[model samples]
Target: MEHDRTRTRAWVLHPEIKSDEQRRVPEPALEEAVALAAALPDLDVVGSEVVRLQRAQAGLLFGSGKIEELGERFHENEVELVLIDGPVTPVQQRNLEKAWKVKILDRTGLILEIFSDRARTREGVLQVEMAALSYQRTRLVRAWTHLERQRGGLGFVGGPGETQIEADRRAIDEQLVRLRRQLQKVVKTRTLHRAARAKVPYPIVALVGYTNAGKSTLFNGLTGAKVMARDMLFATLDPTMRRVELPDGPEVILSDTVGFISNLPTELVAAFRATLEEVLGADLVVHLRDISHEETEAQAQDVETILTSLGVEDDRPRLEVWNKIDLLSSEDRQATLARAERDPAIFAISAVTGEGIAPLLSEIATILQGARHESTLSLTFAEGQKRAWLFRQEVVRSEEQTEDGFEITVLWTDKQAARFAAL
Candidate 1:
């Protein structure tokens, strides 16, 4: 469907709440919020500001004076939507919308909108819809009188209790159940596909990083796949995979996954778990970092937090790819290169320029080589499926046919061995 070219005039506000302990600079946070708002199609970010607050007001979020000031600004700008850079309670959202006479979306809601717009695959679409419904369920705060009605009933066993909000919530819950069932089917298909890949015995190299961290750029550069590499945040929502050949090393499957963000909404985390399981199953994780960003360290920390939450093992093989070196000044670039040189596990490269990629690929090949092992095994004649799967994987170096079965020698990674065992 074609989107309207006339964009929605939107204003973004980053609440610099003094009591909040996050270390992100308010200016960068506001800038990120603006970028996030811009990521949505047909959104013209009219203005953005960091609203400083000594403390948050339970009902309004901001003080009366600040609210009135922002309200004036919104009116002057004719803002159609207000994007908050942090969480806004439903009460605060309702009060602010009433006060400013514009729709308000908190950080979570804005991210959900972006995900909803970007989701492509069946699983991704279903996940986004479920997450949006889950979020909308919380916002059913009698925003409309049509949603405030109570079903007629006696005041006894089945009293006049179920309000419109309750009914809506129930309906949403029902939809969620249905979506979950559909999602499970999609996940099952994905699992079968993953199993098929595992039978190929290719070491999986997963790319993970903060949004707009040049992961897709590096992925395209490395795998030569024309994935949607863009400057926008969350540009690649669906996980993409391609077989990549390493220099003088075994061929491996490289996966580009959804980007991570600081304070990613709980709804997205829960909804995208199936997508993220690819990372969990990976043989090696390549963390791509935009070293040029001022908040690079903080962003890396956020990625770490998300990975930890996803149960990525500390001992998992990982390499850090410090990307976007082209964006840095000469001196800073030299410093980054020097830092990377001192660390065997870290590589500095500009994905856009293809600088330092050859060495990175060589390093990846070396790591995969170290992880590979050769073994011999025998399968009974009854296990013809397993025998054919081995041959299809081409892992069988030599095989001898016997009356009962076939004896085979194969080369595979530990992950592959475990998967075959499970099969």
Candidate 2:
């Protein structure tokens, strides 16, 4: 299989629409798109450019002269695939592909391809498949010549005159239904596992950031679990959790989740919500930023946008983890350290060399400490099981016996308090 693989020659283009209100700076966006194209193993990026546009043309997405010029570049470079850095309508995609005589993939399509290639766990694979099918269902336009063919059906079902497009759409819909059913079962099992974890006294701390922002590296450093840590985009597709013990704090469940990207497809965000439940349920979320990157602030904004869309409560405890400090120059590092010193909410650390890790851990312990509260409760003698459970959890800081019942004071987290109430 490895020997049979052939790399496709690809060209990436970022459209710079002057009238568009939400466009990022063209150069960095183009660089990011090129990196996205390179993330696929079987793609050799031949060239990339930022195409200036006053406004998008509905039919072709670019002016005729610009289209012809890009076509010439594609021909000169022998490009087999063209990746657009933004959304392209179905009609525009079809027309552009015909004009350039090469396959065309919009930003959403490119992301789906990368996800399909990188998905590892069963749930991740299923979610990617569903998202790809949802995206494909929308692109079932006149792009393919085969869509002009007519398919034969039963007499009761349109009498052998169904267009190929209808048949294909129906097939995709059927597949989506099957995939949804399978996903439901998988999600049900996952929910059960999460419930089990909720019974434990450990708090969950989830690591989230943009792709290639050193989240997996930090996770490995803190938990000593060998997850796939690399400088590649989407290197860690599935969520990985491990038990981590802090110096003066209780053990915690540390989770490393999929990285967020700018303009992530809505289908993907919806499909992977279940995979990101760890982040939503986390007692503390650590926003790990690659402080060395030029667009670190913009990347952090993208992460926050996605988190907001995922319904992460605004009041949830959060910490800003400025990772990759080792990549900074001495002067820049000093500035970062100064900034961190002034802001108790931020911690600058290098996951590779373990620099500032001890202090970061101490900070995490402090934050977790803030989540705990002490409460006094009165339970009757009949509630022996609940009493035993509380004692087993070692949360019984103080206890007293009264005439009506035994009064107990327990120092515990909100999760523990909820569990005790339920009992």
Worst 10 residues of 1 by lDDT: 153-162
Error of 1 at 241 (Å): 0.7
Clashes of each: 0, 0
RMSD of each: 4.9, 5.1
Worst 10 residues of 2 by lDDT: 1-10
The residue pairs in collision within model 1 are none
TM-score of each: 0.87, 0.86
Model 2 alpha-carbon drift over 4 Å, by segment: 1-5, 143-148, 156-159, 369-423
Give the CA lDDT, 0 to 100, for residue 332 in model 1: 96
Residue-pair clash count for candidate 2: 0
